[model samples]
Target: MDFSLLKEAMESNSFEKIADICDQLMLQVSAQGIKFEEDWPYTIHLLGHLYVNDVNSARFLWKTIPSVVKEKQPEVVAVWKIGQQLWMRNYSGVHEAIRGFDWSPQTQGLITAFSELYTNKMFHLLLSAYSTITVGDTALFLGMSEENATNYALQRGWTIDSVSGMLTVKKQPIVTEQKLDPSKLQRLTEYVFHLEH
Candidate 1:
C-alpha cells in the first residue's frame, strides 16, 4: 500500500503498529473465506521474505515446489518431496543473507526500511489472494486506519472496486489465530522487529 507510510513505520521501529497491521490484514483474508494451508509453501515464502526482504529469492523457493501430491502415487509424492527439499535449501540462503548483512548501528535505518518493504510485499501477496478486501480489514492489516489503508491502496494503484470483485470468489478459509502468550509476542517483537534497531 503506502510504501512511504510503511517506510516510516519501520524506520520508527514501530513493532506494535506493524504487528497490528499484519493482524488486520490476516483478519481481512479470513473474512473473505480464502483459506491458506498451514504448511503451504506460500506461508513459508512469506516468512522467509519477511525475515530477509528478498522477494526474488523467495520466489525461487516457491517455484521449486510441485502443485500437488498424492499419497497413493509414488512418483507424484516423490516429486513433491523433492520440491520441498529444494525449497528448504533455498530458504536457508535467506537466513544466510540476513546473517551476512552488515547491520551496524548506523545501518539500522536501512535494515528497518528493508524490513518494512518485506512486510508490505508479503501483505500484497496476501491481498492478491482475495478479490476485494474490506477497508476496515485492510487498515487493520496495515495497522492503520481505514482511510489510511484506502489511501495507501490507491497510491499503490489498487482499486477498491477490484478488491471487491476478488472477494466474490469465495474459497475455504485457511488462516486462523491461536492464542499466543504475551511473552512470546514480546520476544518475537524484540528479536525480529527491534533487534537491528
Candidate 2:
C-alpha cells in the first residue's frame, strides 16, 4: 500500500475514501486471521502505546476488559485522560504526514481502491464486535451531540466534513477543497479588523 497516498487522503479530509481503504485492509487482515494488534494489545504497556497511535480509540476497553473477563490482568488506567492526550498527539502526526499533496485523479483512484478495502474491513469488524461497538452505533449511543461524535469520526478519517457543517451521509470521492463564500470571508475579516481597532 502506498502510505503517501493514504497520508494525502487523510490530510485532505477525504474521509469516505479513507474509511473505505481501512475497511478493505481490515477485511484482508481478518481473512488471513491477522488481528489488529495495534488496536488490541494484550498487555497494558502495549495498549498504552497503541492508544498513543490513535489506532485504538476505546480506552475503556483496556480498562474494563480485564475485570470483565474475571482474570487477574494488568491494569493500565493510571492516567485519567491518557487516551484523549494521545489522540491529540497522533492528530499532529497525521497532519504532518499529509501536509501537502496534490489531489489529482490518480490520487483519487488510489484513495477509492483503498477505501473500498477499508470499508469491507470495518463492516467485518462491526459484525464481529471485535472490541467496541460499531462507529455508527457508538455515535448513537453517545447521544445527539453531532459535533462531538462527528469530531471523533473525523479523527478516524471515517467521515468527511462537508458544506453547512454537515458530513456527507454516504461514501463519496475525496473533496480536496471546501468552497467558502467570499462575502462571508469578507464579513468575518471586517469583524475581526473592527474588533482589533
List, residue by residue over 109-194, the lDDT tens digit for candidate 2: 43343334433443444334433334445344333245665665555545543544433333335669989999999999999999
Report every candidate's CA lDDT: 0.47, 0.42
Q: Please, what is the TM-score per model?
A: 0.29, 0.21
Model 1, residue 131: C-alpha shift (Å): 0.3
Candidate 1 has an lDDT of 0.47
* lDDT string, candidate 1, 1-197, tens digits: 22344345556765335433433554565688866433222332233343443434445544543454233323323222323433564432332343344444533453455445644753565456766677766654554556766777777666666545222223335898899799998898889877688
Tell how far residue 197 is off in model 1, in angstroms.
Answer: 74
Model 1 TM-score (2 dp)? 0.29
lDDT of 2 at 51: 25
Poorest 10 consecutive residues by lDDT, candidate 2:
91-100
